[model samples]
Target: MVEAAQQPKRRKRIAMVHPKFPPSFWSFGFIKEIGGFKTVMPPLGLATLAALTPDEYDVVIVDENVEDIDFEINADLIVLSSMAIQEERMFEVADEFRRRGYFVCMGGPICNVLPGRCRPHCDVLFEGEGEYTWKQFLTEWEKGEHADNYVQEEKVDLRDTPPPRIDLLQTSAYRVGCIQTTRGCPFNCEFCDIIVTYGRKVRAKPIENVIKELQAWADAGVDFVTIADDNLVGDRVYAKKMLKAVGDWNRARRYPLAFYVEMSVDAARDVEFLELIRHANVVETFLGIESPRSEQLKETKKFQNAATPLLDAVKIIQSYGVVIAAGMIVGFDNDDVGIFEDQYTFLQMAGIPIAMLGILQAIPRTPLYERIEKAGRLRSAAQGNNTLSVTNIEPLKMTYEELVTGYRNLFVRSYTLDAIGERWLNNVKQWGSKRDVPPFPGKKPEDPNPADEPNRKWIQKPLGRPRIHLIFATLLILKYYFAGGKEKRNFALKMMWGTLKLQPAAFMQTMNYLAYFIHLREYAEKVVARDEKFNYVFDDKNLTAESLGEDGHINMVKNERSKKTKINVNDAYDGAEVTADIAADLEAVQAR
Candidate 1:
């Protein structure tokens, strides 16, 4: 470990930049506008990298989504981390920094998958988890010896990881804080690249370390947090112990923090686990129920989802007071024309208010990518936005046109005002009705041997000083209540009434959902319009290996029907001027 007081012979200045992200379903700019924040969440990975840097180096972190980068600051090195969707902008940023004679270093998931494309722009590239590789790079650099690439052949144990440098962030810029509890998933879904990146063995931090981090956040006055785990409860025993510790920690402080997480659908089967999460004050979770058809699940090797009836499992989880945001994908090899309707009906029947519908894309090096590549059905590299009504692989049972059309229709129908309102009402009602049970029954409420309380308070009154965004959200909801048609007006009233009667916290959460719908509905419409302009055809009966290119991409030609349509980002809401600049900024990045 590097000591904080150590000083190198030569002091170095480093600038860490997080590249811009594209507009997508989860951009949540609309919600950010109403919630008085700039981004949905801070780039925790970049923050962690900043913490890993040697203490002698002066580091400054900049996230382009929150603020513009200052090019005037002189720095010895520039470091970047990004996803695949931000590849173009990332390259542009790297070129700009390299032009100014700064040594550029790049790493993250994108670099791991596409190192060949990323190598030319960087002086050094750190590929796998950086807990160990980063330290090695710093040591070598200080001695004037640096390599073009440093990849970790072995995964680092989670126990040795340090707390992320949250002090580097402008805390008020994001709506919620982020923390990662676990590293990998045990399941082998064909299209998933998680195991390829982090291995199949689940690695987690010790419970004491987790609590110490949470206590740090609590001291910093962070009220809402998002756990950025691939699967929070992949190992049931570890999860139970962690949740029990968290529950005890929260109860002692009067429960100030609320959390959100991502987990597999199998969590629904564990009623005891559900109650534990509820007691820990987890407000929501996202589950990857990729498809409703058993055959499709089998083809993708998502056996956990295939083993159970989908709707029953959803209801079972909601019965314990946690809202579910489901992920649905179409265009699998086994999906036919009817799969679209099946997906829509399943979400409606299951009362999932927030369903992320997408066409499947085979990421590079995953089992699905290898299978499709060998079958000569690959089309192109994934654009990293799976919900964009486009697929990168040729389907076996359906044409590309059929798949795009079905995906477009599903997105449009699912996010309509009436459709979303109905689902939200049902979900809020179900969540409100669930009884809050103690995770540890028959245990005394008092702590037997109380330790000294941290010299900080956790809870902050939300209604004390109303933010501008909250006021805007209120006006919009009221406008829909009074000016909308009878059905919308009635639905709005019932939502407010139910939330007030059951859980007051849910009213704000529901408002946030409505804000999200404003963005997603508009994006869906744009995708549908974009799809309508594409002209293509496929012949299933006469398909041949010659149709695919040497690089495993399919060759398709567009007809005269192809015409680009300009998309307006401000068409979804009535009072959208507050967030108009956000849309303009994203459009400018997209153009670059």
Candidate 2:
């Protein structure tokens, strides 16, 4: 063994790689076409980790989303950061780097929540917040300890946390910048891992610190940002103050910034909060309106959403001119196959055009995982991209095969061109015509990056975003109309006439929704096609799996569902799922 005093004094080189995300709806794959950006939101956690890294080290960030990883780059150690969705690629990179005799360190949400799976792949693993643990590791590394793991025993304090190394980012490559103003969430939804990783108690950065980060992003030419909080309204009092400060700051700027945020649906009840959001130039809000049905809502312990009539709550927020992008899920104990049509109808009525419709998943470290594991009901590991109907937990009410069929149908029915167009145009009419509509969230107003921004002249306009470069608009209109068949021309005409007739300012937003159609429809089709290999079809009109009873013609899968087995939604301790009763449900499925 080498002596500790014999270590080289030379500056260490660290290669920090942010893993590539799998194809998912949330990735906004359409950004590359219209915005010329590689991704929507940048990886905030990795960037923050780089800040925690010591000054003497030469840290180079390689975001796989913007550019491919250069394995030959100079480095003494390799650091990989990833979310649960990026775990597969994270491990592959880790194992490769280790094979080449490099010490690989892994952290971020993937490692924090699923350390067991990640531990074997990485030489050094970090769990929970890296703020304190990373510094501890750095101290030990300099002393040549070569420790295998470092974990933060206690939650981090945001006040003392250093600003992320934003200077290290290749900022221009991303369409929407991201900054986390808070850590942790208040609610305890059983299947969710947000509270699992960050915990239920919320921690927030100071207002001044947030503005400092905003100004840093502004300097880097990013004016449109997404507040990457698990739930921004987790602490209503703190959120209100931060919103006011941000709104004031944005309004004072030469070119105001636009923002998007995620919060619980109950935020609609707080008109003061909505006012703050509007003044803050927040153009969009993603609400976890997981299900339209009250039973499903209560079942997940997502009490905030269950407290309100979802459709009315969605409309209340939209009336403030902030468009709502919703999260919808299927396969609850209370859910039968009929949730497909139920959710689709609810989304249309609520005019929530953008949705991340996914199936219920038992993520690692969550209550769902423990219960399902105990019941011997887990089918496969959850890869964290729920959009493709992948889930580890077999539901208490439906067979895995039948669940997948309804899931596939939900995507097709929800994303059908006609369905999306109707919702899109209707939403534009409701909010777009009121002149209260927020500016289209995009690049900085004055100077958008030419190479990355598509149709720059049209999208960079200040305030209401009323001006569209007619020449460029004409080209896009012609390209869509004549490029394909009947649907193409109709959508093309709809894009042009819809925006122009309803609200001129809504042109960019109109184009955005149209691009979503181009992406979501094809994506849905591909996911459905991949699932077709199992050879099962369930009628979209069927109310439940039993309704297709002994039908030789309608339902291909004869998976039985049990009404007898269910865990009390209130039994969800804190934020963890308590689905011990689901064993009976799965046993019933096995019997069929």
* lDDT tens digits, residue span 366-430, model 1: 88888998999877556566776556689988888777666766778887766676566656545
How far off is residue 298 in model 2, in Å? 0.6
**Candidate 2 structure quality by residue, lDDT tens digits, 162-250:** 77888888887887678889999988999888888888999999989999988888778776788989899998999999998987777
RMSD of 2: 10.3
The deviation in Å at residue 16 for candidate 2 is: 0.5
Candidate 2's TM-score reads 0.83
